[model samples]
Target chain A: MAENPMEQFEVFKIGPSLLLNGTNVSLTNSSLFMIISVFLIILFFALGTRKLNIIPGKIQVLNELVFDFISKMINDTAGLDAKPYFSFILTLFLFILSLNMVGLFPYSFTVTSQIIVTFALATIIFIGVTIVGFIKNGVGFLKIFVPSGIPVFLLPLIIVIEIISYLSRPISLSVRLFANMLAGHTMLKVFGGFVVALGIYVGWLPLSFSIALIALEILVAFLQAYVFAVLSCIYLNDALHMHH
Target chain B: MKKILVVALFLLSISQGTYAKEGMPQLNPEFWIAQIFWLIITFFLLFFLIQKFFTPKILFTIEQRKNLISNLIKDSEDYKNKISVLENEYNQIITQAKKQAIDESLLLKVELNKRINEKKKKLADQLNIETEKVEKEIDDFKKKTLDNLPEIAGNFSTEIIEKIIGAKPNASNLKAIISEITDQEKKSRYV
Candidate 1:
């Protein structure tokens, strides 16, 4: 029998460990590619916006399209005051999106498929938003956890529930991305295995399904990035406006 | 700070336990460190490029367009005011020209009337002089004719008498003829 369909997700170490005081510290393929993706994103944007001319060239046009798109997104979701966050949000989106797309390549790891990576990103956003809330509102930041209009008697319980809800944000944010990428990739692999196992006559069906799923996965990759950025904007809006 | 420390300790313990699990792949700390390093690098680079290059250019273009529009508006307003002033000046010149023409015509009429009156006065003076001269000439011719009238009557009577009596009249008859001629002249003058 062929290997289990899910076994492809296993991580294997391929290099010697660099010992620092007898502790193993080493880089992996995943780390290497993550760094490479960041480098590429930086290079692309650097070259794209180098010449800021009146008439946009091809690269400049692409850059403007992305800039306009993100600016509009933040404006629509968080209002005009959110203009300050446009660059950060755009960068976050592009980085995540490119990582997701590169993950789709053969023999490459999906960094977001791992919980640690997604959790790390989500943690940064959560902490950043919380800091923004405190910085903007001072002691009034606690008001986010204690919504308005609740009776004094019910305030404590409600505040606790709100805190729990707030704490769950990172988990939900990370899991949503990780689960979608993991499930979609696993299914694609399973379908691909079926195409090889079954004869070419019956294999065409799974092959076609794989193709369709790949297309859907590509769309989902872009959508997940958009969702992540938009949610961050919403969180930032709550921080800035305290609209909870 | 305490929360961060607690979270770090908790993560470290969890990682240690997970590392002890048989057949499980080791979690590489360097991987995360590398990711964090790249993340900071990329974020700052992008932020600087956008802040320094892209944003300023866009804002400059927008400002330039605004200045251009304002200049055009100012120029148009100036043109409108100039046109209004020019129109007013044009009307003023036309009115002045009309007034000048009316004044010139009035002056010409006054000059023409004065010339006519002076000519009529000169003609009247010349006519009075001519009438006086003509009256003098007529009176002189009348006097000359009246003086010659006695001689002409005497000759006529002499011829008549020669024919009737076959001889010239004597001094007494001549005196009587002279007296009759004198009486007739007196009667014509009185009448």
Candidate 2:
């Protein structure tokens, strides 16, 4: 049998140990790529807007397209009151999107495929939005757990359910991105193994399937990033407006 | 260049851990803390970089470009309005000038006609006085000639008889004959 397809997700440490409070906080390939993604993002924006000309070049145009897209997404979902959070939302979007795209490369490790990474990100957003909720609405933020127009008999049950769902926000958000990346990449690896093992004689079928899967995976990568950002915006909106 | 340096530094930092470890290291509890540690560092670094530096500059450029476009449009509109106002004012002045010119021409024509009629009336009066004077002079000349006709005829007949018959005719008889002839000529001319 061919090598296991699941082996692609293996995380190996990249650098020597730097003992941080007795934890193995040594740099890993995941961290390397994350840093690389951040670098590329900064480079893209810095160079794109360096000229600042009235008539935009290709890089500036691409930069503007992304800028406008995220801005519009925030404005549409979160309303004008959420304008203060524009930088945070935009940064979150660009970071994840860059990581997702970088992950698509062969022999590369996808950081978002790790549950810890996505959960960390989701948790950050959840905590931040919760803080914002409290700060903006004070005690009234707790009212989100209680549905209006519910019968007194069902109030306790519905509120419990609502709170549970609210708490599960980070898990669902993180798992959604992690699972999609993991499955899509795994399937592609499996198909790649088939192409190699079967050779040229019967490999064409699996090769074609791999091509289709790659295309779909690219789309999923972009879509997952979009879903992540949009959901965060919606959560922030809930906090800002306290809308049910 | 700075971005490339940052990427290179990151690569250098992580280059030491490319060693093969057994099984899926992602599931290994030994690596989770490290992964989370790196995740926090990377996420926040990127977030601050973008938020503080990249986002503001890009949005500023876009906004500046938009403001430029709107200002250009506004300036062109103002110019158009000014041109239209000037054009309307020019047209009004031209119409007023044309109306004034026409009024002046009409007045001049009325004044010239009045002057010509007055001159024509004065000429007619002068001509009537001169014609009356000439008519009275002609009446006096006719009266004086009629009164001298009998004497002038008696003298001329006496002279003519002496010359023709070698004898002078009687003055009174010739006078009577001349008077009778002149009376008959006068009756023929007058009646």
TM-score of chain A of each: 0.93, 0.97
> What are the runs in model 2 whose C-alpha is more than 4 Å off?
B1-25, B89-191
For residues A13-121, write the lDDT of model 1, one tens digit per residue. Answer: 4477655575543555655566667777766766765765555678766776787788889988888877777667877788788878888887777776655677788
The digit string of per-residue lDDT tens for model 1 on B1-191 reads 43344345335656666542232122334345544544555556655766676656654544565687889999999999999999999999999999999999999999999999999999999999999999999999888877676676677778888899999987467757766876797688869
Candidate 1 chain A TM is 0.93
Clash pairs for candidate 2: A13-B17, A14-B17, A15-B17
All candidates: CA RMSD in angstroms? 13.7, 11.3
Please identify model 1 stretches exceeding 4 Å from their true place.
A1-25, B1-191
iRMS for model 1?
A: 7.3
User: Model 1: clashing residue pairs?
Assistant: none
Q: Candidate 2, residues B1-191: lDDT per residue as tens digits?
A: 43344335334534644422443334455678888898888888878887788788888889888999999999999999999999999999999999999999999999999999999999999999998998888878777788788988888888899999999898888888999999998899899
In Å, residue B99's CA in model 2 sits off its true spot by 8.7
Worst 10 residues of 2 chain B by lDDT: B1-10
